[model samples]
Target: MVPEFFTQTNGRGDGEQTLAPDSSFSNLEEAEKALQELAQVFPQPHSFISGIGLDFATNEVSKAAVPPEAPLLNMEAKYRALVEQIPAVVFMAYLDQGIGEAYVSPQIETALGFSQSEWLEDPVRWYQQIHPDDKMRWSVEAAEMFLSGKPLRSSYRVMARDGRVLWFQCEAKMIRRADGSPWFIHGVGFDVTERKALEEAILEISAREQRRIAQDLHDGLGQHLTGIAFMSKVLEEKLSDKSLPEAEEAAKIVKMVNQAIENTRQLARGLHPVAAEPLGLFSALKKWASEVEGLFHIGCSFQCENPFPIHDVNLATHLYRIAQEAVNNAIRHGKSRNIVIGLSGKNGAGLLAIQDDGDGILKKQASQPGVGLSIMNYRADMVGGSLKVQANEGRGITVSCMFPIRSPE
Candidate 1:
């Protein structure tokens, strides 16, 4: 078999789409020669050979894009040095028990206060360092990568050796041998603690401002508008009793004032969905579903067959925003006609899911999610939950967020 290499990057979480082969080589020497030439094509050494492979049947080159495991360390000193100095923590792992880390860059110490030797010494260090709340989701997502041979993009918090919590945005791809068996995992993790802090600050500030505005709309403007409507209705009645022509204008003013009050109330609800009590989330969602059906001409329903108490207001708010964003995406992007919002909790675990019947997602678009989806993910992450977006069987998209059920002490 001719040793050939394909130039394909598993990206956008849509690895099922096939990539057309770029170029091929007739022999090992030819493939090696092409590797040297690839430096000019891709300036980054790691990216130049991230998913490369060759078949040995006829000694001809098969695919020729990125570098795989064996050739990585075999490269020139300059190339290896370039990889070690990158801003992120680069790593390679064997597909053995514990998914042992085979190689890690020096950046690990800088990011997590652990030297490379210490990290590599123990096979279970990686698993042990994960934050307790994040371990379950990490294992689930990692399993998806192993099973599908697709790239994994996940962000979660991990504990440093110093006992400080840091956020990491980890992305990894599984490389397979020519015989289709798993070889090793090549990945990178970037420390995002500062960025996460900034995001939290911004979201908190925005949430506080929203709560203020919602309160003004609900208590201040709503009361004022109610007074106006009452006065207008009284004037209309008095003018009608006096058989005056101005009664028609008074009735119109009363109708407009009432409509304004309803609009303001809806806006306030949108801004601050969760209330003082935990069960407020359930009532808010039900009301919003009715609003969506009326305003968007769609069929929207909220389901809470078994809702347990969630005493944390922040948790309730986060869940509400997740559902709101998912439904908006369904209506705006997916062009959905029917939407269902489901909330369930049992045995100290909770789930929020939104399913919609719409145009669903195109394979290409599925990889490139918009801003709304990205924020929804972060919103879920804020409350120690995981968000998943998947296309429905025939037509539509489903957004699900799962978390543990807990109340603040």
Candidate 2:
């Protein structure tokens, strides 16, 4: 008996398309005829009829099965939907081809007011959108990360399409081919503007409080100590004229009061170096070094090579504090016998570097920095500079801060 035959529409808009049973054709002529019809409908190379079947006895056929294209299309649609739904902007770039962004998630539009198409269309737009002051550092850091194939982690400001300055913390890693050659890069960016604003606010408040306390100590306590020392001197002179045994003791008391007054003045200076403004950074540094050497019995020297003037008092103060902190760390932690503080300026930039000839920072301590190092870094950032603390080649640690100097206008 001949097998049953049935035809099913393949759901394509084309009316002529049909499915046939998975059975042998009745004859070569019938098989040829079926193939010719399929070719006319789905004209391409390498077409196959899987379910179509025929019996030679009766020319009967069975039902056909659906094609593999349906499942693949569904998967692709789902993947795109998932990418678009993510909150953060997911990006992939072809590093080998001039760092072109191959894909940017849909969230970019909502985050930065720029469509994915707009970002992908311009390869240089990303670099161009960086804030002018940050462009050089950002480019250098990015280039280093790309060259070293290291994970890129950076926090920077980007100007969005609508002229909004947004801060983003981005992290990306190099993607490599099977043979270990770099293929591209992929990363995610998160908005950090609000967090940065909060941090800046806190830093400002702290700075204001420190200035107030320093002023109070200098104006209030320092004046009172000076008056006490003067009164004690006058009392010592009166006793000496009387030729009393208490005269010697009074003289000693006068000396002790003078010492206390000097100590109070030193404490006030420690709180905030008021001379930093009038004396300039160079003189303040020299005085500070002298004080450190006298107090700690360590060989501390300040050298300035072509010391350009720093008119901005706040900038000078921050730089002085960073140097002070570094010196203190070298003395207290490193037990340094000799420390060198150098200040130099060249081509609209200033550098303050401190090197200690003592026991170098331990590997563990370097990896896990303490509060002192953190404060130093924060101060460096406030002065528009970067702080680098590294162990010296032979011994000890070196702390360097390089900052920009605005030319007089």
Candidate 3:
């Protein structure tokens, strides 16, 4: 609040002139007249001007006080400090195009060699740095998240400023208004390059072991079983020639040995080489679906309305294994009676969807995925694809993998 007058003090005229203590006027006109009269006696340059701050609301002299926005400003500072000090790259941006609040942490410079200012300066810089191979799926998934208000959790490669390819496990959720409109997105991206490398090493070792066991079952155990069956049949014929009841016992031994051989072959097939089929993933999946139906006694079907060749062997392997795992999960965990596997490739991308007719995965279970689900997700990521497990509300679950059909020649 402004006071009526600011008095000049510590300067006197030719004699000792004393000023009145409470000579302030109520109106500015009276105060101006008194100030002009006083200025004539004591020249302005010789005196110091001073005034006491008055607080009329309190009816007392004004004292230092906190502004209304102080607490909120303090909380903002605290939260900003917390976010900046975290290990991962933290970001906040509006879910919509209109930028209400935008922030990128300092760790971005350490992680990707880009300063916080540089990242936030351009709105699309984050998307631009995504690995070229992963951009399309990211765009599609991001759009879905925006429209459906679902949280985004994914892992993909990003190109850093130093030309290094880094894998990141990114997770984000949308903040909404009271009316349920999206306000902003708070996200964190952790550098998982080392973790991904470790996971790949483990999967490779596991695959090698599986192939070794499959080879042994197919060649070593299967040949031994075949020999036993052949010898038992010879014994059964000899016993029959001798006109003895032992021929029936020998016939049972032959039957058991043959069954063992068939079981060994089935085990070997389940272990490996389905991915190495000549007709690529389509025929492999079709044959696998038939095998699943015959073996498990479940109704399984394969669909390929539009089919194309998958030239890349590793890609075929990944796709085949993904379908295999999805089907296995349906039979084992879901207890599904019917399963549908769909394959389609056109343009440069395709989808492999496996749907089951059983109890869908519970939401609680999905949050903590099992080992098979984890492996399936990893396989899809290795192939530059995204895997989505959608529950059909007590009907069943659908596991879909979206992947780019093109790979290096």
Those runs of model 2 whose alpha carbons end farther than 4 Å from true positions after fitting are: 1-90, 98-101, 147-152, 162-164, 175-181, 274-283, 303-318, 343-352, 378-386, 402-409
Per-candidate TM vs. native? 0.73, 0.68, 0.73
Candidate 3: pairs in clash = none
RMSD of 3: 13.8
lDDT: worst 10-residue window of model 1: 51-60
User: What are the candidates' C-alpha RMSDs?
Assistant: 13.4, 11.5, 13.8
Q: How well is each residue in 1-409 modelled by candidate 1, as lDDT tens digits? A: 1123544546768654433445566776775666655544555634534445433334345555434655655575667689898999999987754534488999999888999999998878999998776676777778888887779877777899889989888889999889998988889999888988888788788888999999999999999999999999999999999999999999999999999999999799778888868688888789889989999999999999976778876778888888988898899988999999999976555789999999987877777878888898888877767788887898898899977566456
Off-target runs (Cα >4 Å) in candidate 3 are 1-68, 96-101, 277-280, 296-298, 308-322, 328-337, 346-349, 358-386, 391-396, 403-406
Q: How does candidate 3 fare on TM-score?
A: 0.73
By the lDDT metric, which is better: model 2 or model 3?
Answer: 3
What's the residue-level lDDT of 320 in candidate 2?
91
Candidate 2 residue pairs in clash (backbone atoms < 3 Å) = 5-61, 21-51, 21-52, 21-53, 21-62, 22-51, 23-53, 24-54, 26-56
Q: In candidate 3, how many Å is residue 314 off? A: 6.5
CA lDDT of every candidate: 0.81, 0.76, 0.80
Alpha-carbon shift of residue 84 in model 2 (angstroms): 5.5
**lDDT per residue (tens digit) for residues 90-121 in model 2:** 89888577534399998888888888888889
